[model samples]
Target: MNLTLAIAIIAVAAGVIAAAMRRVPIGQVHSLYRRGQPLRLLEPGTHWVVPGLDRIGHRIDLGGQVLRFEQPQADSHELRGTVYWQVLEPERAEATIDEAPQLIRCGALAALGESPLAAGDRRDLGSRMKQALNGALRERGLMITRVELEIA
Candidate 1:
C-alpha cells in the first residue's frame, strides 16, 4: 500500500509539470531569459519554459517592424522620424530588452537637448537619434533598414 501511494504521488507530480510547460510554434519567435542570461530562441512550436523562472520578454514575427518618434522643442520646432527594423538575434533581444533601448533613448535625448541649433536643429537631431537607435539595435542583432524623416 505504501509503495502504491508513493507511485501515485510521483505520477501526480509529473502530470502537473506536463501541464505547466508548453511548446512554441514556427514562423514566430519567443524570447526567453533567465538570471540575466538569454537562452535559445523559441521557434514556432511547443516551447516548455520553467514554470516561474524564465520569462518571455517579447515576441516578434518573421516579418518586419516599424517604430516612430517625435520630439518637439520649446521654440515650436520639432524632429520626427520613423524606423524600419527586424530582429536578427532572438536571444539578445530577450536578455536586453529592458535596458538597451532605455540607455539609447537617454543618450539620444541628451545629445539633442545640448545641441545649439537655433532653429531647434530638427534635421541634425533626427539624424543623431536615428544613429543612436541603430547602435542600440545592433547589440540585439536587429537590423535598421531605413529611417525616414518628416516634418510634424
Candidate 2:
C-alpha cells in the first residue's frame, strides 16, 4: 500500500512539472493570468508557469495582419474592405479590447459612406476609413497601416 501511494505521488508531481513547462513560439505571444486575473504577456521562447495557479489567457499574434470584412453602408450598399494592422503594444491590446478584428469590422461599418462609392470615391473612402479606424483603435494599441474599401 505504501509503495502504491508513493508511486501515485510521483506521477502527480511529474504531471505538475510537465504542465508548468511551456514554450511560446516565435512571432506569437501569450498573456499569463494568475488566479484568473491578468498578469503579463510572455514573449517568444521557453517559459515556466505555475500549474493550476497561473494560466495562459490568450495567444496574440504580434505580427502584421490583414482582415477582410464586408459590411453594409448607411445607404444599404455593401462595403467590402481589408484592414492592415499591427500590434504596437501587446499589453494594451490585451486589456483595451475584447477582440481587435471585430472592432475593426465595427469601425468599417460605421465609416461606410452613405452612397455606393465610385472608382474615384473608393480612394477617398479608404482614407476616411483609415482615419476612422485609427481614431477608434489608437487608444486600444492597434495601429492601422492601411485601409482599402470599395462598394461591393
Candidate 3:
C-alpha cells in the first residue's frame, strides 16, 4: 500500500513537471523580454519555458481584440469610443509591447493625443482617435479593423 501511494505521488509530480515545461498554446501569445528587449514570442501550440530563468508572461490573443475607451467629459461634452485590432505578426506583437492591454491602451491614447480636438468634441475626437490608432498600430505591425462609437 505504501509503495502504491509513493508511486502515485511520483506520477503526479512528473505530470506536473511535464506540464510546466510544455510550451504554451498558439492561440495565446506570450511576450518574452530579456534585458529589457523583446526577446522571443511563444505561440499557442506549446513552448518550453525555463522554470526560473525565462519569465513566463500573460497570454495575449494573437487574434483580433476589441477595446473600448470611455469618453471623458469635462464640462457638458459626451465621450465614448471603441477600437478593434488584430495582430499581423504574432512574434512582433509579443515582442513589441510589455503588456497587450497596455499596448492597446497606449495606442488608443496616442491616437487620441495626436488629435487637435478639445474636450467637448466627441465626434471629432473619435474620428481622430481612430486615425491615430491606425497610424500607431501600423508601426507595431498590427491592423485596426474598425473604430465605432457607442450611443450610450
Alpha-carbon shift of residue 100 in model 1 (angstroms) = 4.9
* Candidate 2 residue runs with Cα over 4 Å from true position: 1-10, 72-77
Per-residue lDDT tens digits for candidate 2, residues 43-118, read: 9999999888899888888889998988776666777888999888888898754588888887887787456566
Q: RMSD, model 2, all Cα superposed? A: 2.4
lDDT score of model 2?
0.85
Against the true structure, what is each candidate's TM-score?
0.57, 0.84, 0.61
RMSD per model, one decimal: 5.2, 2.4, 5.0
Candidate ranking under TM-score, highest first, comes to 2, 3, 1
Q: What C-alpha lDDT, on a 0 to 100 scale, does residue 8 get in candidate 3?
A: 100
Candidate 3 regions off by >4 Å?
1-20, 32-39, 73-75, 95-128
**Candidate 1, run of 10 with poorest lDDT:** 114-123
Compared with the true structure, all predictions reach lDDT values of 0.65, 0.85, 0.65
lDDT of candidate 3 over 1-152, digit per residue (tens): 99999999999988767756746665677776555566676766666654445665546676778877764444434446677888787665655545555666776665554333454565665677667776776767677777766434
Write one digit per residue (lDDT tens) for candidate 1, span 1-152.
99999999999989879866766666578777776566667788886788667877667565577666666766566756566666677666655645544554454555556333544455665676667777767877666666665555
